[model samples]
Target: MTAELILKLAGGVPAAFAACLGFGIVFNLRGKTLVFASIGGALGWLVYLLASGFAGDLQRYLLATVAITIYAEIMARVQKTPVTAYLVVSLLPLVPGGGIYYTMRYFVSGDTGMFIETGLHTLAIAGALAAGILPVSSLVRLYGQFKKHRLAVN
Candidate 1:
């Protein structure tokens, strides 16, 4: 059991690392090789694992939000770029496009219950993502301010 657990945890790192590398490449393609791309990828995988373990859309959404916010702040600082770039890419994994599509299809096929549930889940994910990011961004900004002040004082 311990070995299995260790294997799972070990498996996650390479997946996360590759994801981060891919994100980094894409972000770099845009002339911004901010470290946040890698950070966002790692955070996204971590959130996905944790959220999946919880077996709920809300948890996934919240995790995605947190990941996005952290990446956004880091990108802003490292690349001296706008937060939107980081925000957009970081959110790519959690957008629930598949959910939305299935929900619409179900509705067209006259499955109201599935449609409603899926729709709700989709909305919850969206809400959670938004909720998770706001506070984190504020905190990052605060930290940045503190660092700036300390540097100036020195």
Candidate 2:
């Protein structure tokens, strides 16, 4: 809400967007699909920043992943594309790149204590991200099934 926060978000969002855009390109997404994928990443980062104040890192990543996954699902349906196309790019912003790096760094540096701690932290964050996506995707699948059953009945 403050100007400082707004500026920070402005700076971060474009980085998130670019990260998604870059990954989308790597994954062979093009045109409008790539744009939407970038938007998803930016939106997820915004959500993470907003929720970070209220929760720890794991919780923040979980919240952001859930939001982006839902957005990706909706976009996929509207665009008649696979959800993975969008979800994969969107998740770029939320991935624990730093955690993974630090975990490896600690291990290579021969710091067993830090390595174990960082490794566990990275795993927990990764799990949280997965936990966020599973429920929403399942619900979407369930809704599709119910719809199919209803239409079949008709």
Candidate 3:
């Protein structure tokens, strides 16, 4: 809402987009699929940025990952591709790159206290992201089962 917030979000957009697109390429996504996956990543980062103001670090990752997973699953269904394609790419943006870096940095600097703290925090964020993905994935599988059953009946 504020100009500063908008500017920050704007700055993040390209990083998110690039991270997703690069991952998409690495994952061999082509054409519209790559674009859609990239959009998912950017949108996820934007949500993370907006929500960070209100949520703690773990919560931010959880919320962002949930949104990206949902987007990836829907896009997968529509695009006739495996959810992994989009999910992997979309999640690249939300990966705790900084956390990992700082954790390792502290460890190498012999700051065992800071290293332990940062390492635990990074692990927690990773856990939160994984937790976010599990439910949506299960829901998608359940939906697929129900749809298959209905189709078989009719």
RMSD of each: 4.5, 1.3, 1.8
Model 2, span 37-126: residue lDDT tens:
999999999999888567887889999999998999999999999999898899988888899999999999999999999999989989
What lDDT does each candidate get?
A: 0.71, 0.92, 0.91
* TM agreement with the true structure for every prediction: 0.67, 0.94, 0.90
> Candidate 3 residues 31-115, lDDT tens each?
9999999999999999899996889978999999999999988898899998988888888878878999999999999999999
- TM-score order of candidates, best first? 2, 3, 1
Best by lDDT: 2
Better of 1 and 2 by TM-score: 2
Question: Between 1 and 3, whose lDDT is larger?
Answer: 3
| RMSD versus native structure for model 1 | 4.5
In angstroms, the error of model 1 at 9 is 7.0
Tens-digit lDDT track of model 1 for 30-117: 6444445555756776666656655575776786578668767867787887877677666666667788898899999999999999
Which run of 10 residues does model 2 get worst, by summed lDDT? 50-59
Q: List the residue pairs that clash in candidate 2.
A: none
Which regions of candidate 2 deviate over 4 angstroms? 2-4
